[model samples]
Target chain A: MTGWISEFMNHPATYLKIGWLQISVSNLLVILLMLATFALAVFLPFPKGHDDTQEPRT
Target chain B: MSEMWTAKLRTKWQKELPIEKLLPDDQPAYVASWIYVFGVLTLSALAMIIASGIVLAFEGPAWYHTSDAGKFTNSMHFWSVQLFFVFMVIHLWGKFWMAAWRGNRFRTWATGAVAFISSIATAFTGYLVQTNFDSQWISFEAKDGFNSMGVGAFFNVTNLGQMLLLHVAFLPLILGVLTVVHVLMVRKRGVVPPIDAEPALSNRGPQ
Candidate 1:
């Protein structure tokens, strides 16, 4: 049992647990993505008619 | 009771608002051109990507990379990601130039923009979960770049399990939800018109 733990730690793939669920560049990109998306959602207003209070001027 | 109040409020707004029920005569004769289709196409591609991704989830990584059915689906997912970005960028550019946000459509534009960014993240996470030699190599290389840039501390990129959760669980959900909301808002608001056009009914030119 002790040997297996050491062996896994030594392997490069151990960091990602790659054989099953692998992690790396793609995930980081996703993180960058989530941050960007979340930021945008918070800032941008919904389309005009979305606010019911506004009366059409024309 | 809240639903009733909400319905009553909506009915009040409908009666009071002087909103345009349909396109005015001043609006463009039609969507500007083929460029307009890029946004919809990108959306289609995103839908395919999610569908393919669900299958990959069911089959597991090894099955996806090794089995023929799995491999084809994986390739389709990969190609769809590339296609989505291509079309989405074009759509973004098209909207920017056309000034597609002139009228009530600002939220639609913003949502689409968010979806573009979110989809890219989803694609990035999917790439990380590929678990191949390329995936392995790219993770380490990408991390070094991030580390140098100061983003490495938050996300290691070298960890497969971490990447998988973010990719399959988090990124997709974010992108999918954002895209859906954007689409709904677009349907609700209708498209914005070309800049400088008069109302569609009164604004007449060459017919």
Candidate 2:
């Protein structure tokens, strides 16, 4: 099990470089994930609760 | 009518943050957005970090390096810290776009900003105390930056004992206090309404 897991995990890291700015592929993926999550949070409909129809408090 | 200090303090506390406000059963309708959930997600990650950190502290560095159980616990701590930062950054982004400081909530935003900085410092100390070649190299490299900034004399990142104490005790205390104050401020001020929501709700300050 450990051997298989280690084999899977041990891989050369890929980095993206744009001039002096460089970031690992892993880091870039995480950043993209964050952006996607933020977009989803904005657009996704929230689950309705008992008070879903309540008037907006002023 | 007593003028005792404790009584006066109690009255002031109640007046400032009554129980209903502190543990509100309901929030404004605009708060139903999924974006608002990231704050609680950040807090959950922080709780996981503290729990895993406590386990790591109990076992020490050598055990974590050599033993399976300790290594698992160490991984838990590492992953928790990662999640904490990820959730916290998302929360920060959400709050920033929302203009969370509106309606006299500048202190809320300020405390949260300070807490984020404190958390970074805490994570830096944690890295320094890792008792590995990575930590050694990082400290050696970081010292120059600290020295250039004129804070190396006090911070001393290379000193394991100082870094360990700072990570486990000092920074956590500061972060905890900031988090409590931030949450209380949120409760007191109420959630900031959406940008396009009612003008009156957006302008409503602390109660």
Best by TM-score: 2
The C-alpha lDDT values of all candidates are: 0.69, 0.91
Which segments of model 2 are wrong by more than 4 Å?
A1-12, A52-58
Output the number of the lDDT-best candidate: 2
Model 2 CAPRI quality: medium
Error of 1 at B4 (Å): 5.8
Fnat of every candidate, listed in order: 0.00, 0.68
Can you write out model 2's per-residue Cα lDDT over B49-167, one digit (the tens) per residue? Answer: 89989988988988999899998889889898998998899899999998999989999999999999999999999999999998999999999999999999999989999999999
Superposing all C-alpha atoms, what RMSD in Å does each candidate have to the true structure?
Answer: 14.1, 2.6
Model 2: chain A TM-score against the true structure: 0.71
Compute the lDDT for candidate 2: 0.91
| Cα lDDT tens digits for candidate 2, A1-58 | 3788778657877889999999998889999999999899999999987894577899
The prediction achieving the highest DockQ against the true structure is: 2
Judge candidate 2 at residue B30 and give its lDDT: 83
- The 10 consecutive residues of candidate 1 chain B with the worst lDDT sum are B18-27
Off by over 4 Å in 1: A1-58, B1-28, B196-207
